[model samples]
Target chain A: MTGPRETLVGITDVVKHFAGGGNVLKREKRKVHAVNGVTLAIRQGESFCLVGESGCGKSTLARTVIGLNAPTAGTITYRGQRIDDLTPKAMAPYRRRMQMVFQNPYASLNPRMTVQTILEEPIRFHFPRLSRAEVKAKVEEVMLSVGNDPHWGSRYPHEFSGGQRQRISIARALMVDPEFVVADEPISALDVSIQAQVLNVMMDARDQRDLTYLFITHDLSVVEHFGSRVGVMYLGTVCELAETKALFANPRHPYTQILLAAIPRLDASGFRHTRLAGEVPTAMDLPSGCVFHPRCPHANARCKAEIPALKDQPDGTAIACHGIEEGRI
Target chain B: MALLDVSNLNVEFPTRHGTLHALRDVSFTLDKGERLGIVGESGAGKSLAAFAIINLLSKPGRISGGTITFEGQDLTAMDTDALRSIRGNRISMIFQDPMMTLNPVLTIGTQMVETLQAHRRISHAEAKRIAIAKLREVTIPSPEERFDSYPHELSGGMRQRVVIAIALLTDPSIIIADEPTTALDVTIQAEIMALMLDLCETHDVGLILITHDLGVVSEVTQRVNVMYAGRVIETGSTRDIIDAPKHPYTRGLIAALPQQNEAAQRLNQIPGSMPSLDGIPPGCAFNPRCPHVGERCRREIPALRALGEQQVACHSAEEVAALAGNGGSAS
Candidate 1:
């Protein structure tokens, strides 16, 4: 809800391909086309959400933006500065500014380490010269901010519940007071009630710390409640980008429409969803033009041959579909 | 008599520490072709109730009390051999994970044929024919081709379709699907749910759908049983319970959903996590997290009593309903 937006993270035509172990009998070399030419920006103090099914490269794109994985092609800029090509030593300062919270808190947290050590490890790694007392104070402050009791710091992760463990993970992320956070399905592992607690914690931290978020999740409801801007990704490419309300109210892309229609609403009178014809194709063997064209009902010959560019609309939304461009859908 | 009537079903696990009651006084009735949803968070014993109905609880976890009367026969009193006859033949189950439910090495055809032949006196050729027909019923494309494919060869959605097809092979009167679509994507989940609902209606099969997602339950179920801490806190028609939940926990659960509240606003979270079964609180298990907790709630366990169309087990159900009517949080 902040005004005068300034770009915090700028991703320009980024492509990340993993070298797939091709069929041994055929002896063919191929790359898993994970993220193919995605461009977007996370403005200052806004929650930018990426929604898609499994293996859609939302995670890969988040990782690429946060410098976890270098892009196979294109550039990732932090505050207009190129951080993609920087060395690990050179990327230290950026790492301190950018933090990540993963989906599963149980697996992300070490079983042996106490909560104190887990929260303290990040501070120690990022700020090596900080005193022990300073780090402890910071940990206590972060834990309190995230609604985790400081007394429970002595207990191991297993002692705490899933919600508490997730709060601890969020606390660890905020220990550095990061300007940007890439939370990949942070609350998906918890129950609905617990999910609310974690979401509130993240929202509170964002407000208090003035943080920008790149939230990746498959659950559209969370995106609607949490995100300011939403990007609908399908088969490693973002098909549509719009403000959260605009995306939900008036979805442009056929994929986005189907995805929105698929959500089982509590208010829905009956079970109804747009059933797509085909399942997600393997990343190793992507279709000719649009990855979704095979399954898309509105796909024409142009959609089968040429990849559509992201076209800006008057309503402040971007869509990448030939059907939308030609007024066919 | 109801098609399947479970009265005061108590399931327990005899651990070394003590006997932990996993499901306490869990009672519900599933009429012919009725779609009943058992909704709860994990460890709330919704799944345990489903397992208890079929006498499929694992070792140490057994149905300690109450009667599961199906077709005027007590399933709880039946021996293993007798129960085995009805376990899959009369009441089939579809588990959460389709991959785990199906055999990895065997082709889909072999597994389906074996299951059908085991329960019914049918030839292998007949079983195969029936299996393919069932596959076609579930909308699996090219049923013949898919029958020869292994479990791993199919996608997650296709495998779930296969699982549903296998569950329908015997023409069972009842189907217990525990989180049937929880493992799939939202789109796939919607498709599977639609197919399941369609099949149940057409075949006139009773369904006991156990899931954590209230949205799914609201969409798919005719009646819902809201379980909390091993007990059915509320039971009513889907519309009534979802629209005006009488129980504080039920209200909180519905309000806690992101869509229920304003976008970007703080969700109405029920404070604290679900109590573990072994250390469930005395009196009311939900007292710790409930907003409308009173002295009576902390001292005495409320019985499920009828309040109009809904049966709610809360000391302050009337108060909750009144406040909920005013668009209040019921605090």
Candidate 2:
């Protein structure tokens, strides 16, 4: 536990673009730039949170990292080995080491499958040599770890409440004992009380199993509580990356500042929020230089013409804004 | 007289098995130009209370008992023609989804003009002028150009701005917004809430905000009513409720927030989930999850009783408030 932590997943300049908006007669096609030129590293046993608006492509990047959607470019390395381009058979081992949890538990878990069957299917597919009794023992252990009753394994997903179903979803992800887990908005669909329960379950699983996470969510409050490090995404680009405390205390990028200022805290009132001028531009028709330049208040002529690259600050935070580099912000 | 008063409001849906009580004995009053927030979980009947105020409950769901008094008139007893004038003119509604509220085919300007002309005897040109001015009031950029654009042409935030403009078009005395910004991003939601607050204050319009987000409720509303199961368990000033809640359920709700906890610490999660409407527990609906539950809680339902500056429907409100002196929890 005291060893030097190493980078578990190294993502370099990843890009994902989808072909969208074609016509039957006019034959017009446009590229929806979902995740573009995002570079980040997930260290061992750290919960790296990616936060942004709905269309900011944070989910797209998470899906791309897990190989659910193939990246249009760039490389994803797992423990100094390139695994993004591996074939199905070759990628099977890496898949066992990495698992994903989706946003909606209602849709993620199969209604027809019992808890035992759902937990056992992954083990059977990954390691066919394991006996039924061994698989059952593993399922019971994981179920109990997540606070679900092992005796209720015969019940279906619908029998459990939403919070219990989400716990089951976490248990399913841990079935493979993956070293890394990518949970995309795991608690967004839950109530406030239930959200805490699910988040606690995830935190406990991380501590007990020594797991690393790439948690994606739009909620800044949850990120403040759960994230070790945070990356703020705007139009598929990482605008700011820092420790959660640093990000919340002193957000450097203009977009990050606006995003943080908009969160309605319980301690403050009177409807005060920093006003951003315009709405987020569509990804299909992104701005020329910086994707956020159209809405950024600190944007200048250079910002409109040249894209800003992520520059490291002396305090270890990375910001992608010309204004920050020029001391204008 | 109060601008709007709801007393002993009960809404129910008659199902084949039995009648499902969606809301029970909910009572609150909204003064002129005042903002009241109705906060609870999803199935706590916050939206149903709002829907019942305007006689807009969907099929089979009706107001079983209560009085919705608007300007000294009982809205529940009013005829369709009398209520029609009050629905969008005296009091208007802003739904959660802007796309659902705005007609997809109709342009923004047309919807605004139609809404204005429905109640007032105004010409098309005068109505168009008022529509554009209302749009400008909401700070929609280039109101003239946006008026001509269809609902699909604008972004989500812009569409909500247009919805707010329409709600304000008739110069209504009160606006009932039910989770109006829940579909938008946080940044957009903040802007919208601020804009609504500004308009409500400047125009002297009462607001009844229904949402599940406690932070937004605390920031935008002066008073809040905490609903659980079907009843309003706690009602008090927003500051009082946020600073020191009386009800155990309300305390648990405030403590459950991620912001209330230390960084990376486990949140103060309530033990059980909210019961379904069909299978509501007897006595206090929150007795199963209440930390201060007693034998009396399971035997009889608690009614709203005055407790210094607030009204709470919990038998152990005094003990709970004393135990958790501040911050609602051990955190």
TM-score of each: 0.99, 0.98
- Report the poorest 10 consecutive residues by lDDT, candidate 1 chain A: A266-275
Chain B TM (all candidates): 0.98, 0.98
Compared with the true structure, all predictions reach lDDT values of: 0.92, 0.92
A1-329 per-residue lDDT for model 2 (tens digits)? 34548999999999999998667588788899998899999999999999999999999999999999999999999999998899999999999999999999999999999989999999999989999899999999999999899998999999988899999999999999999999999999898989989999999999998999999999999999999999999999999999999999988899988898898878778768788878889889889998888888888999999999999999999999898899998
Candidate 2 per-residue C-alpha lDDT over B1-331 given as tens digits, one digit per residue, 9 for 90 to 100: 8989999999999999999999999999999999999999989999898879999999899899999999999999999999999999999999999999999999998899899989999999999999999999999888889889999999999999999999999899999999999999999999999999999999999999999899998899999999999899999999888888889988988888988999998888899899999888888999999888999999899999999899999999999878667535654
Model 1 TM-score (B-chain only): 0.98
Q: List the residue pairs that clash in candidate 1.
A: none
Candidate 1: CAPRI quality band:
high
Clashing pairs in 2: none
For candidate 1, lDDT tens digit of each residue in B1-331? 8999999999999999999989998899999999999999988999999999998889989888999999999999989899989989899999999999999999999999999998999999999999999999999999999999999989999999999999999999999999999999999998999999999999999999999999999899999999998999999999899989999999998889998888998888889999998778888889998877888888899999999899999989998899778874423
Which window of ten consecutive residues has the lowest lDDT sum in model 2 chain A? A1-10
